[model samples]
Target: MANVIRRAEERDAASLQHLQAATPGMPEWTQVHWLGLLSGDAIVVIAETDGEVAGYAVASLLRIPGEVVAELEAIVVTPSHRRNGLGNGLLRYLLAEAQAAGAIRLMLEVRTGNGAARALYQGLGFQEEGLRRRYYRDPVEDAVLMSLQFPQEAVAVEKGQE
Candidate 1:
């Protein structure tokens, strides 16, 4: 399947809601939240396959003491589209967007039971940083924190040219 990853627009709210509804294990975000995100500082991207929203990823840029960080808020893919690289595509797009926005690090938390997600993150060079106990409610699961740090050399080179 050919998948196109693009920035989400306000008009995509309904399709995003529908896609989220069809996906389990995703955060229950309201329409208000979706709209707010589209207008907020958060970076959101959706994967489209054959004219349908297949998956999406959200991240927020944060200014820390000495660096900008991108915190991955959510990532969800419809069940029927799993294992087809939609998830990976969404994540890679997010990473590129974050880096372009001056993020020096990308962080995320995933349910410990979600082996597939963990594998995906690891495959992309995200290292396990820590764990949050009882981070999820519905099933009372732990959350594994993972992070991918951009190479310092790359950041330095970019800064040097500025």
Candidate 2:
């Protein structure tokens, strides 16, 4: 599909809120929250085609003394746009940005019933690290904690020293 993925803007808040509402199991974020994130520390991107939003991804970083940890807050694609690689594209964008920002690892939690999302994460090199019981409401499901660790050796390879 001819979709463009770009940094989200304040004007995207309302549309994103609507999309989040239509997506089951997604946290309902207020327009104010979305607007605040536009200027906040999170890395947020949206995919659009024909001026219509197709998907979006949000990620935030936590800095430690020697390393950066990134959390994938959310990734959502409209039902009509599912299976077209929009979600994959959004996630790949976050992964690249986080790595460039010095993130040593990426983390996220998904409801156990979300097989599709879990599969996507695994396909992208995430592994199940732990589980939180009853971490998701509405249906009260377990949350599978997943993480992807970037190898420090990659720096040497990128620097042409390997």
Candidate 3:
């Protein structure tokens, strides 16, 4: 099936909500919350296969003391769509978007037990940095923090690096 990845629109809120409901451990966001995300500063993208919303990913730019960092807020693919590279496509698109938006790094936290997700992040160059104790509550799982750093050539040049 042909897959299309694009920026999410307000019209996608319902589909997103449905996807969220179908996925366990995903944040239970109301349609209004999803709509707010589409209209807010968050970067949200969806993958459509055969005109159906197969998956989506969300990230937000965070202003740190001296630089901006992108955080992967959530990513979910319908159960039937898993293992088809839709998640990878959504994340790759988010990575490019975050870098283009001047973020120096992208960060995320995943449940320690989520091997599939951990593998996906590692395959994409996100390194494990640390862990948070009891970060998820449904079954009280720890969260493994991961990050992907973007090359800061511009910043280095500005700091007088050749």
What clash count does candidate 2 reach? 0
Model 3 C-alpha lDDT per residue in residues 1-162, reported as the tens digit of each score: 989999999999999999998887676899999999899889999999999999999998998898888999999998889998999999999998887777888999999999999999999999999999999998999999999998898545444665
lDDT of 3: 0.92
In candidate 1, what are the lDDT values of residues 95-152, reduced to their tens digit? Answer: 9888877789899999999999999999999999999999998889999999999887
Candidates 1 and 2, the one with greater lDDT: 1
Candidate 3 global TM-score = 0.92
* Candidates' C-alpha lDDT: 0.89, 0.88, 0.92
Return the TM-score for each candidate structure: 0.91, 0.89, 0.92
lDDT for 64 in candidate 3 is 82
Rank by lDDT (best first): 3, 1, 2
Report residue 131 deviation for candidate 2 (angstroms).
Answer: 0.9
TM-score: model 1 vs. ground truth = 0.91
After TM-score superposition, what is the CA distance of residue 119 in candidate 1 from its true location, in Å?
0.5
